[model samples]
Target: MDVKEGDVLNYDIVVVGGGPAGSTAARFAAKEGADVLVLEKRQEIGSPVRCAEGVSLSWLEELEIDNIDSSTSRTMKGAILYSPAGNKLKITERLAGDEVGVVLERDRFDKDMARLAVKEGADFMVKTSAVGLIKEDGVVKGVEARYLGKKFEVRADLVIGADGFESQVGRWAGIYDSLKPKDIMTCFQYRLTGVNMDPDFTHFYMGSSAPGGYVWAFPKDENTANVGLGLQFSRLKGEKTPKDYLDEFIENHDDYKDGEAVDMVAGAVAVTHPPEKAIAPGIILVGDASRVVDSMTGGGIVNSLKQGKIAGEFAAEAVREGKFDEEFLQKYEKRWRDELENKLWRNYMAKETAMQLDDITFDKIIDALSNIELETVTIGAILEGVKKKYPELVEEFQNMI
Candidate 1:
């Protein structure tokens, strides 16, 4: 099974991208007896990381991922959400497991995930970019790719597209891959040291500074944090970019003003309505490539990782049964949707409603939420409380609850 340069290789399953989702899919598929191979466009598995590196502990536990301590930076207990006028609403882990997740050493986390996939008998190729699909009679058969400037073909019975938000695989397969500007969040983040803040809580600022989105301050350690902001591109009314807003925010905040900036990153996150289909004959999309990110939270690592496991398991099953058509691959869509699509859709609608709220409405929400115990809070309960004070607004959100 050695893959030499300029030689055509074959695998039972070929996963494009070596991110968490790709690695997870490769691992599970290989474990189920498929000859799997992963192609990462980058020279290294996890270089130039583009994430905030935060994830929920409960889901990680559910995934049964081991050796997590190697990549864990800090464990959070809860979150503190601030209104436009700065009113605070605190929520503990008891009510929100994701709010109390851990900050990760993202590079290490990715590398470890890929390593695990290799241990499960999956082959990996870095500096390998999948340029196009290998199709026969209108069905995907594999990928046309390049490695270290040499082009080659990889034939596989199944293809898993974990190539991220701007997924070429999804596009090449004739699936709808374009996202409206309103559905995309332009973000800028700075990893800073010497910032003094509580390491146990993640801070969120909701207001016009980042219209239709929020600013986040996630602690990596006691004196270091990832300070960033994400704003819906459609709501960007003027010339100022997310970077400008973030700089202004840091200047106004006492704790972050003097912090030493260690690194900076910029990217766009797809928060659009989920596609009607993430699968086609002989292929399936996973992770950001599938746009599984929660619109409200702008987070997808957990969902993406979970879907990777689902897709991998199903791919192996399909290969074993000699079924690789859309009808069979559709089951992969069904299983993941059953597990996460409902919640993702709900959150997307909720985010739409929240984005339209005025500053006053947010303040009212914070006030109402303050009156309730965090442990007893749910979407319905919070909306019910809001009804007592703002019936019209609550009515509009009733469907969301």
Candidate 2:
């Protein structure tokens, strides 16, 4: 429906933001016969691309995304990790963590996700922004939204906040806190053409070159790749930015120095552990709004899709049971946490521990791992290998083991 000024709309569930999380929530909820609506602030479902477009394929079957291959740009076999001192460690795609496996054409991927929701009977309005929450005696009841230049109200039995990192929907409901500097990664990226590199493996460079974060090159094609880096907010100096570091790295690399940048993107990612609470009466926060991005890799696609499915199904159940209270919503909270909390917490701690390592220690750790033939790659297994070669280096990571 076209929303005009003074329009008052209603739905069983309203999802704010139309990225993977919001779309997934809408798709699942509408599939269950809920009257669902999604409002995206941007003029299109996905534009002004802000991601490196890397994702792990292992979760696709679980997410039930049937046409993922149409949006995939390249398939990665594994990833090569380079330490500051030039030590290299290669890990297979299955063990390379969540960010490696396939590179996506994110704009197309996001649109495809939203299309799935619409196909399931979810109504979506692009250029619609949720400006505030509507509350009834301290419980969220709906949202005050602006569509194009017209303002309106959308009342719903439940509201899902799937807004991105700087989400305001969760804050308006008083369930989200601002991220600390140490927990934020300011990022920048470029799609470069004519890059000479292996297309089969994703590349990562660690150390002082990208303090507290790392540099990545995810191939989009045989000659094009997304070259990017994230700089930990706390480690950033007044003048040097993520772009500066990225530019230096590219200039120093023989393969990338001659490449031409055809596209550029900049954004911030929350690298904190998931929030203690993401639920309030009639409202649930998912994706970056709830800080569910992996603290170690700054990846959120898989986690967002998982949380969205959980929230959508629960929202549908809430409408059927006539239960929109906080107590009723606790089930959604518990299920998502049970599915993701342990790994998120572990990754958060690992990121914290990694930030303390110097170049020498990083090299020692990577070099040690490179020398071993591990049948399985895991935190405990990697630590065990490092412990055999350099016992002192594994001390700090003992807790993670």
Q: List model 1 lDDT by residue over 1-401, tens digit each.
A: 33556788989999999999999999899889999999999988878888887777767666658648898988888888888888988888787855468888888999998988888899999999999999899878999989878888999989899999878999988777578888999999999899976778888888876888888989998999999999999988788999999999899888788898899989989997788999989989999999999898899888888999998899999999989998888899899999989888888888888888888888888877877664545677778877776787797887766
Query: For candidate 2, lDDT tens digit of each residue in 94-189?
Result: 665553579999999999999899999999999999998988888778899998799999999798999988888888778867788998999999
**How does candidate 1 score on lDDT?**
0.87
lDDT of 1 at 158: 90
**Where does candidate 2 have its weakest 10-residue lDDT segment?**
92-101
Clashing pairs in 1: none
Worst 10 residues of 1 by lDDT: 370-379
**Highest lDDT, which number?**
2
Query: Against the hidden reference, what TM-scores do the models get?
Result: 0.96, 0.97
Cα error, candidate 1, residue 250 (Å): 0.8
